[model samples]
Target: MDELGIIEQGVDWRTRLGQDIRDCMINDILFSLQTKLQSTSTTLIDLQKVAARIEERIHTIASDYGDYLRRICLTRGDLDSYDVLLNDCQRQQASIRSSILLHQENKQGDQIVQAKRNTMGTSSSSVLSNQVALNDHKEHSHPYEKDMISKLPNDLVQHIMSFLSMREAVRTSVLSHWWVNQWTFLKSIQLNIYWFHMDREKFSSFLDKLLLSRVQADAPMDTFELKSFAIDRANCWINHAIKHNAKVLKFAEYGKWEPFYLDPNLVELSSRYLETLELTNVALDATIFSQLANSCPALQNMLLTDCLLEVEEISSSSLKNLDIIDCYILKDLSICTPSLVSLCIKNERTDNSSFRNSYLIFATVIIIDASSVSSMELLAMDRQFTFVEKDGGEPMFNNLRNLSLGLWCINNMFSPLRRFVRHSPMLRMVTLRISPLDWKSHLTKEHQEMLISIRDRRGLILYIDWY
Candidate 1:
C-alpha cells in the first residue's frame, strides 16, 4: 500500500474512535438526567399528596369554625371578620392547588423536552435530520393532532368562535380550510374598530363585507356589539343586526363631542327580540324612553353610560335591571320602571373636572319610584346629588330589600337616607360606602342619632364601608 493510503486509513480510524467516545459521553449524561427526572417526579407526587391532605384539613377546619360561629351568637362585625378569614383560607387552598397543577405541567414539559433531546442529540446535522423525520412521522401517524379543533362538531366550533371578536374570528379562517366559514355562523359578534389594524376606509369595507356575509348566510344573531369612534355606517350595521333578530345589542361610540344616536326606525325594528340594550356615549332623543317602553316588550336590562339623555321620564314595564352611570341628563329624569328588580345609578367622575362640573350643573335631579325595585344602588361618590319625589310626597319603596348609597348622598344629616329607611317596609340591608375624603368629615350628633335609629330597626342590617 502507498504511504498516502496508509495515512488516510489512520485518520479515518481516529475520527471513528472520537465519535464513539462522544456518543458514550452523551449516553452517560442522558442516563443521569433520566434518573434525576424520575426522582423529581416521585418527589412531586409526594408533595401533591401532602397538598391534598392540607387542603382537606383546611376544609375541615373551615367547617368546624363555621359550625362554631353558628352555635354562638356573634355581632355582625365579628361574623364579617370570621367570613373574611374563611375566604382567605379558601384562597390559600386554591393557590396551593394551582401551584401543584403548574408544577405537574412543567414536569411533563421537561420530560418531553428531555426525551426529544435524547432522540435528536447535540449534533446540528443530526438535530435537523431528526426534526424533519419527527415532522414527517407526526404528519403520517398523528394527522388529527395538526387540526384537533377541526375534529369538533361544527356547532361546537362555531360556539367556541362566538367568544372571539368579529375580527379575531374572521382571522381564524386563515388557520385551516374547516375554519374558513365557521365565523359566519357565530351567534355573538363583537366589532371594535380599535381591534382592526386598518384605516377607516378599510375598516368600513371590512365591516360591510362581514355583515353582508352574515346576511347572506341568514345567520340569526343572539348578541351584536359595536364599539367605534363615530362611524357613519353604524346605523346600517345596527339595521343588519336587528334584521338578523339580535337579542342583545350593545353600541358604544367613543366620540364625546359627537356621540352616535340610535335611529328611531332601527330601534323599532330591534324591539321585537331585544332583551338587553346597552348604550355608551350615545345621544338619546327625548322620546327614546317612551318608544322603548311602548315597542320593546322583551327588553329586560338596559345600561346607559356617559350618554346624553334628553328625556323627562324612563318608563319601562318589562325592564328588570337598569344602570345609569355618569350620563349627561339635560333635565330632571324620572325612573318609573314597574318591573325593575335592580337599579344602579353611579356618577363618579373625579378625574374629569370639566365633565363633572357639566354633569352636576346639567344633571340636577333624579326622581326614582322604587315601588318594585328590590335592589337599588344610588352612588354619587365624587359629588352629592339628592333624589326626591316629583310630587313632594313621601316616597314609598314597597319591595326595596337591598340599598347601597354613597356617603355624599346619605351624609346630608341623613335626611334622604332616613326617608328611604322609613318608607322601605321590606328593607333588609343598607350598605354605605364612604370615600377617603369624606371619611375625614366628622359625623354630627344628628347624623349619629339617625344612624342609630335606622340601625335599631328590626330585621334590617346597616353596613358602613370606609373605602
Candidate 2:
C-alpha cells in the first residue's frame, strides 16, 4: 500500500484520459462527415443514411465496455481501423463531389453549344404535330378504371390541363362532356400558326374562337405566347390578350421591320399586371419606354431581340432584369432602373462585314444608372460603344460581382476596361469570350497594348475561353 499502489492509481488515470481523447476524436470525425454530406447536392439522402448507420455502429462499438480504460485497451487497433475507414469515406466523398461537378460542367457546356446554334422553330408544323401526338398519348395512357384523374376537383383538373399545350387541353373535350368546358378556363393561352397545319386563316380563326369561348370565364390569362413567322391580323389577337389581363406576354415573330411596328398603347394597357414581356423581331418607338415607366408598375423582366428601339433611354422603376440583343436605332442606351439586378447586352452586329450591314448597330454611348446591378455582360460582335460613367470619377459599380466582356473589347478598349476594373471593387470574375476570327488578329499592336495594360492591373481573376 506504498509506492506500488500510488503508481497503479496514476496508470489507471492516464488510461481513462486516453480513452476520453479517443472518443472525442471519433465524435469530431463523425460530425465533420455529417456536415459535409449535408452540404452536397447529389447523393445527399443516401450519404446521410449511410452516415447514420456508421454513427450507430460506432456508438455500439464504443459502448460495449462500461469501463473507459478497459474499452480503450480492447479496441486500440479498432480505433486505428476506424480512422482509416473515415479517411476512406472522406476520399470517396471528394471523388463523388468531383464527378458531380464534372457532370454539371459537361451539361452546361452542352447547353452553351445548343444556345449558340439559335435556330428557332425547325420544322414548326412537324414539331407541333409531334407534341400533339405526345399529348394524345398522355391523355389515353392512364386506364380510366383505376384512374381518379377525372374525379379530381375542378381546380386540380384545371392544373393538370395547364401542363398540356392549348390544343391538347382542348382535345380533352372529346374525351368526356365533363371536360368539355374545362379548357375554356385555362390560365394560359399559347397560339402557334403551325398548330393549324400552317394555315394562317385557320390559326387566326381558331385563336378567335378560343378567346371568345373564355370571354365570360372568371379565369385570368397568366401567360400569353405567340410564335409565328408573321400574323396579318396580330392586332386583334394582341387586343384580346390585353383585355384578358395577360401577366406574361411573349411574341416570337419575324416582322421584318417594314411590316411590324408595335403599338405603344399595348404596353400601357397591360402595364398594370404584366410582369414579363419578351418581343423578337418587332419594331418599337421611344414612346414604349415612357409607357413602360408610367404604366408598368409590376414589370420585372424585359427582353428585346432583333427589334428596333426608337428610343435612347429605357427607364423603368420596377424592372429587375433587362436583356437587349441585336436591337438598333439607339443613339444612347440610358437605362435608369433602380431595381435592376442584371443587364445583358448581346451582339447587334455580326463578324461578317457584308451581313453586318443588316444588323442594327447600337449607339456609341451606353449610360447605365442601375446601382443595384451585380451581373453585367456586354457580348458584342464588334469592339465598339463607350461606357459613359457618372461625373468622370471612379465609376460607381459598388456591388458588381461578375463582369463579362467580348474579347474584342479587351483587345481594343483598354482605357474603359481599366476604368471598369477600378470601379468594380467587389469584382470576383471576368469572363472573356473570343470573337470568331483568326488568332493572328490577337497578335496585332492593339493586342500588345491591351496585354500591357492587363498586366499592370492587379487583383483581377481573368477567365479566357480556349474553345
Candidate 3:
C-alpha cells in the first residue's frame, strides 16, 4: 500500500467519525452565534427607533403643554406621574444601550472564536479553553463595561433611585452584588398601591419590612409620601416618619368611602422638622389640629383635600401656605394663621343649588385672620362670597396683592371686586374666572360695560377668564 493508505488504515474509523461529528457541531455553533449576532443587531435597531420616537413624543408634550403642565403642577402637585414616565423611559433607554453594547461584545467574541478555529486547526478543546480564558480576563478587568450605570458614584445612583417608587427602588437590589442594599439609603420614600401590584396583606407585609429595614439603617427621611387604601399600620408608619424627623409628610387615601383618620396620638408626637403636611381623604378632629398647631413649630405648608373635618377652626402660627379643597366641613370654618402668605379655598360641587342652600342656610361662615396673606384664591362658584375678619375691625388680607375669584354670575362680580379693592390697598390684579355653567351671563353687554366701568373708575387691572 502507498504511504497515505497505510496512515488511514492505522487511524481507527470510529475516531475519525467522532472528529468529523465534533467539527460539524462546532460549525453549527458558530453559525448559531452569527445568527444571534444578526438578530441582536436588528433588535438594537428597533430599540433605537423606539427610543427616538419616545424622545420625540416627550419633546412634543413639553413644547405643546408647558404652560398647562406648569399650572397643573403648581396647583395640584401632580408632577410625580410625569416624572415616573420620564424615569421609566430613561431606564428603558439605558437598558437598551447596555444590551446593544453587550451584543457587540458578544459579536467580537464570536469573531475571535471563528478566527481561532480557522488558524488553530479546529482543535475544539483548545479553542474553547482560549475563549474561556479571554472571557474571564474581560470579566475580571472590566466587570461593568456593559452596564455603565454600575460605574456611577453611589450618591448619583441613590439620587436616581429616589425618583423610582419604593418597589422599583427595592428591585434594584437583585441586579448585582454592588446594588444590594443600595436602595435603603433613599431619602424620599414613596409607597403607592399602584406600584406594588399586590394584595393588601402582601402590601402591608412588604411595607412593614421596608420601613423596618430603613429604620434600622437610620436612613434620612426627607419626604415620606404614602398613597394607599386604608391600612391599620398606616399610623405606625406615620409615627416612624415623624420619629425620623421627616421634612415633608403626605398621606392620601385612595378609598373614598373608607376614609383614613389620623391617630390623635400622632399630633402629640413632636415633628420639629416637619415643614409640609398634605392630607387627602382623611378625617380630622379639632383636637388633632389644635395639637398639630402647637406641636409642629416648623410646619409651613398645609393642604387638605376631600377630607372630613370635624373641626371648627384651623389655627397655626408658622403656616405660610394653606389649601382646603372640597372638604366636608361639619361646622363653620375658621383659619387664624398669622404668618400665612397664600391661601386657596376651592369647592367644586355637582348640585350647586342644593350645596349653596345647605352651605348658606346652615349659618356657616368662613372667618380668616391672615393679615399677611399676599395671594388668595376662592373658587367656590356656587356659594356667595363672604369672609369675616377675626376681630371684625380691619381688612383680613392687609398684604393681599393678587386675588382670583371664580364667580357664577358676572353681573354680581363687580360688588366682590369693588369690596376686595377697597379692603386690599396693595391689591394690584384681580382675575375673574367665569364658571363654565355661567358663560351665558359672562358675555352680557351689561357685564362688559360694568367691567369697563370698574377698570376706569377704580384704576385696577382686571383680567376676565371665561372657562
Candidate 4:
C-alpha cells in the first residue's frame, strides 16, 4: 500500500512541474509583446492627438478669414434667378429641324483641347469653316431679300442666329424689321469679350451695356460665355446671367491675373438652375465650394482651374463629370457619388504648410463608383503634394475602369496605383498623359529605365502631348 501511494505522489509532482514551466514560458513571451504593444499604442495615441489638434487649427484659420474666402467659394446656394430666363423652357425641341449642323473629325485624340481652335462653329452648309462670311453689305447695305426674309418667324431667326455672335446678330438687326425684334430675343447671349480687343474700362462699359439691355429688353438668354477676363464687369455679368439660368457657362482663364476677391453676397445665392459650370481662376475658397455642394442639386458637369475648393470632402450623388485643373489648395478629399462617371483631378500640390494642406499633401483621393463612372483622368506635372522623408504613403484609388495619370506623381502614383490595381483587377484601359518631351532629355538613364520597368509591367495607353 505504501509503495502504491509513493508512485501516485511522484506522478502528480511531474504533471505539476511540467505545467509550471509551460505557463512561465507563455508569461515571458506575453510580457515582451505587451511591452512592445504598449510603446506602439503610445505612439499611435500621440499621433491621433496631433492630428486632432491640427484639424482644429485648420478650422479656426478658415473661420478667421474675411469674406474673400466666402465669396470666391464655388457654390450654388441661394442663387437669385433674375432678368431673362427662356419663355419656352418646357418646349423640348431645341429646333424642329434636328440635323447635325457641324461635325469635325478631331485629330488631337485626347489632348487638353486647344480652346478656340477645338470648338466647331455651327453652320447650315455641309463644310466646317472657320467663318460663315455671309454679310449683306447694305446695313453696311442690304441684300434685296433682306426686307422680305427679315420678317421670317421669330423662332426661325432665333434658330438661325443661335450660332452667330451677338455682334453679328446686332448687325443683322439693322437689315430688316423682322430681324430687329428677334435679335433682341436671342436665346443665347455670348459675351466673347477678348482682353486683346479692349482695355479694362472699355470692356466693363461693353458688358454693362450688353447685360442691361438684355435684362431691360427681356432677351431669352440661355447660354453665357465671357470666360477670357476677370474684371468686376465679369463678376457682374456672371451674377446677372446665372440669375437668368444660363445652362452652359465657361470661364477658362488660363492666363494669370492680379489676385482679387469676390462679393460674398454673390456667392450665397438661391438660383443655380443650370447643368454646367466651368470656372478657371486664380484661386477659390472653401465655404463657397461647400455652399455650392449644398445648393446645386441638379448639377451635372463642373470644372475648376488654378483654384482651391476647401470643402475638404466632396459627396455628390447627382454630379457626373468633375474636372479639377491645377487646383493646389485641396485637402481632405472624400467623395461618394453614385452618378459620377468621369473625374479628372490635375495639379494636386499644396505649397503652404498649413496642416490641412500638408495632410492633403500625400493623402489619397478616393473615388467610389456605384454609378456609371467609367473614365478617370489624372494629370500631375510634378510631385503635386509636399512630402517629408517619413511621409508614409502613395496615392490610391479603387474601382476605376479607365485610369489616366501622369507618370511623375511618384509616391502619389505608385502607392495608389499598386493598391488600385490589386483592388480593381478588372481595370481595362489605363491612359498615361505624357507632357512636353523636354522632361526626358534631362532625366538620367537609370531614371528612364526605372520608368520603363513600371510601364513594362502595366499595359496602358500612352498619350503624348507636345506644347
Candidate 5:
C-alpha cells in the first residue's frame, strides 16, 4: 500500500481539504484527554485524605479498648483477692466450729467415764459393808449361832454374796464375823480354779470345804459348774453336783489342763431334774451317756463340744434339742428319741476323728452350718453318715418330713432318705445333696426315679443341691 503512494493522492484538491480537517479534530481530542486525566488524579488525592482520617479514628478506638482491658484485669485481681479472703474466713469458721464440737464430745466422754467410775465405787463400798457386817456376827460366839444366823435380816447379804464365784464365796470366811460361814449356804456355785494343783488329796480337801459347807448349810442348789476344772477334784465336784440335784450344768475343759472324771451314776444323779445341760471338752466313755439319758428325764436342751462321747445310742428320755460342736472323738452316734426336734452338729472346723469306716454311720450329714435352720441339721457330715445300699433293700423310715444332705457324701445311702420317704408316705419334703466326685453314683437314675415317685405320690418337694 505504501508503494502505491495513497498519501500522495491526498495532495489532490478536495481530498487535501478533508485531510486538514481531520488533523484539527485530533488536536481537540488530545486536549480533552489531558483535562480528564488531571480531574481523575485530584479525585484519587481526595480518597487518600479520607482513608488517612479513618485510620486515625481506628487507632484512637483501639487505644480506648486497651484501657478497658487493663481495667478489667484490675477488677479481676480485686475479685480474686476478695474470693481468697472469703474462703479463708469460711475455713477459719469451720475449723473453730469443729474445735468446739471436739471439745463438746470430749466433755461428754469424760462425763460418761466419771459416771461409770462412781458406780463402781458404790459397788465396792457395798461389798465392804457386807464384809464388815458378816465379821461381827461370826466373831460373837453363841450355841444358838446356826439358828440365829439363819434368822438374821440378811437377804441383801446373801443376794450380794450370790454374785461372787465359788472361790470368792469360800474366801468370804476370811473377811469377818457374819461372812465366816456365809459361802456354805450358797445354792449357785460357779467355780473357776484355772491353776488348781492336780494333787488328788489336796483337791479332795478343797472340795471337802465346798461340800461340807453346802451340806451343813443345807441349801438346795440351782447351778453347779466346774469350768476348766482340774481332774483331781472332778470326782468330788461331780459327787457334789449329783448330791445337790443341779438344775443347769455346764462343764468345759481345754488344753492339757486337768481333765474331769465323769461317772455314769454322777451324771444320772445330777441330770434327774436338769433343764439344760452343756458339756464341752470333757472325756467320757459312751456307757455313761446312756445312763445320763435315762436319769435326765426332764432334760430339755443339750450341748456337747470337743468331747469324746462313746455313746452308741443317743438317748435322752425327754431330750428335745441337741447341739454338738467340734466333737473330734464322736463315734457310733444314735438318736432314738421321737421327741427330738432341733439338732445342730458342726464339725467342718476341725475334728481328729472322722471315720473308722464309711461316713454312713450317721443317718444324714450336712455340709454347711445347720444352726440357722429351725429343725434338726445333720450338717457338713450330712451325706457322710447316709446309708449305702444293703442287701436288706430300701429303708422304710416313712416319718421324715424335712431333710438336708451334704455335698461330700459317698455311698449314696439314700437309704435314710428313701426310708424316711417310704415310712412317711405323706412326707412333706426331702433335700438330697450329691457331690459329683463322691464315690456313690446311686444318686443317678434310681435316685431320680425315687425322687419322682415321692414327688408324685406324696406331693413332697425333692430338692437337690449339687456340689
Candidate 6:
C-alpha cells in the first residue's frame, strides 16, 4: 500500500481503538453502578423488614401495656417515638425506590450504548487487526495527539452534555477550564433528587443556583425536568424556567400521595415557549386547560398523571396530544382542542378513594370537540361515562383512525365503542383491552358479538388483549 493509504489505515485503527476503550470504560461503569444498586436495594429491603418487625412488636406492646404492663412506666410518648422511627424508615425506603427507578432509566440508556458498541466491535475488528503493521511504521510520523474530546468545540461539548443527566454533565466541569462553563450553556437539564445523596434543602439550593447561573448566562433552556418528593420549594424555580422560555417542562413527585398544585398564574406565564408539559401528582382546577389554550400558543402536548383534578371540565385549543392518567378526582372532562390528534384517559384504582364511591352511580361525562383527532384511548375502570356529541351535528371523531377502549368502557350504558365505530368513518383499527379481573368475569358473549359486528360491517380489524 502507498504511504498515504497506510497512514489512513493507521488513523482508522487508532479511532477504532479509542472507541473500543471508551466502550470498555462504559461497561465497567455500568457494572459498578449495577453492583452498587443491588447492594443498596438489599439494604433498603432489610431496613423495611426490620421496620415491619418493629411495628409488630410495638403493636404487641401497646396491646399488652393497658392490662399487663401497668406496673412499668412506659408513656404514650414512647409509642409515638417508635411511630416516628417507623415513618423515617418508610421515607428512606421510598427514597431508595425512587433511586432504583432512576437507575432503571439509566439502565435503558446503557443498553443502547452497549448495543452500539457490539455493532461497532463486530464490524471493525478485522480492519483494526489489518492496521497493526501500519501502526508500527506510522508511530513516529503521527505522535500522540491531544484528546479529541477535549479539543471539541464548546458548542459540540454543550450538545454532548444535553444527553447526560444534569448531575453528570455538571461534573464534567472538573475536567478542564473549557468545560467548566460549558455545562451552563446546556439546553436540557434533567435531575432526579433521589439520585443525589444530598438533603432536600441542598438539592433545592443546587437547582436554584444552577437555574440562576443559566439565566445569568442567557442560556436558552430547551428542556427542564425535575423529579423530587419536595416540589413545593422549587415552584419558584419552575416559574423562572417558564419565564425564561423553556420549551419542555416536566415535574413529577417522587414518593408522595398528595398532589402538587401549580398556581394558575404559573401555568399562564408558562405559555410563551412551552411546547410540551408533563405534570404528575399535581392538583389542577377546571380553568387550567382554558388558560393553557389562551396563553400557551406553542403548547402541543400535555400529560397529567396521578393528579387531583378539582374541577369538572378541561378544555384546550393549542394542545395536539392530551393524556390524563390515574386522575380519579375529575368528574367531567371537556376537551375542545382543535389541534388535538391524540387523547388518552386512564384511571388508577384506589380502594377507599372517592372514585370508588361513584361506582354504582353516574360519575363523569367526557365531551370532545376536537375535529382533528385521529387516535383515542380510554380506560375509565368502572366509572359511568357519557360522551357528549353536538346536537344534530356530525360526531367529533369523523377523522379518527384508531380507537382503544378498556373493560369499563364496554360496560358503559352509552355504548361508547359502538358510537365510536358509527361516527369514526376513517377508523381503521379498534383495540379492546381488559384487566385480568375484568376479563375473567365482565367480558361477555354480547361483547364478542359487538366486536364481530363492527368488523363485518365496517371492514376494519379488531384486537382484544389482556392488560
**Which candidate leads in TM-score?**
6
lDDT of 4: 0.48
Return the clash pairs for model 6, or none.
Answer: none
TM-score, predicted candidate 2 vs. hidden true structure = 0.62
TM-score of each: 0.62, 0.62, 0.61, 0.56, 0.49, 0.64
User: lDDT per residue, candidate 5, 9-52, as tens digits?
Assistant: 33432233343433433343333322322332222123232223
> In what order do the candidates fall by TM-score, top score first?
6, 2, 1, 3, 4, 5
* lDDT per residue (tens digit) for residues 1-467 in model 6: 23432223333333323334334433443343234223323221222322233222223323232221221112222222222122464577678667755555676576564443333322222222222122222221113544345578867777678787655564554345355556656788777665443235545656676677677778887888888653455567678778878899998864232345666655554457889999886767666755676788888889988776666666666778989886655344455677789988866555443212311222464655767889988766645445667678677677799888777666544276788777788999988877678666875777667668868888888887676
lDDT of each residue in 1-467, candidate 1, tens digit only: 23332223334333323434334433443333234223322221222322232222222222233322222212112222222122354466568557655545666566575443443333222222222221212222223557665578977787678678654565454345566566666788776654332123444655676677667778778999987653556777877776678899998875322346665655554367889989987868666777788888999999998876767788877899999897766566777787889998887554443222332333444546556889988885443445555365654677889999886545567777877777777889998887656655657667767687877864578888766
CA lDDT of each prediction against the hidden true structure = 0.60, 0.59, 0.60, 0.48, 0.49, 0.58
Count: clashes, candidate 5: 23
Total backbone collisions for each predicted model: 0, 0, 0, 18, 23, 0
Q: Candidate 3 at 389: error in angstroms?
A: 4.4
* Alpha-carbon runs more than 4 Å astray in model 1: 1-168, 175-178, 255-257, 265-270, 353-368, 381-395, 408-412
Best-to-worst ranking by lDDT? 3, 1, 2, 6, 5, 4
Error of 1 at 127 (Å): 33
Best by lDDT: 3
The predicted structure with the larger TM-score, 4 or 5, is 4
lDDT of 2 by residue, 140-185 (tens): 3223545445577988888799898876675564444356567667
How high is the lDDT of residue 22 in model 5? 34
Please give, for residues 1-467, the per-residue lDDT of candidate 4 as tens digits. 13332223334333323444334433443343234223323221222322233233333333222211232121101111111112232122234123222222333443323221223223211111111222233241234443677557867777888888765665554456444445545677654434223233444555566566667777766777765443544555666777787777666442323112334455452346767877765344555556557777777888876654545666666689888776644454556667787887776545432211322324445553333566777675533422112124432333457867665443433554445444444466655555455456544566556446555666644344444
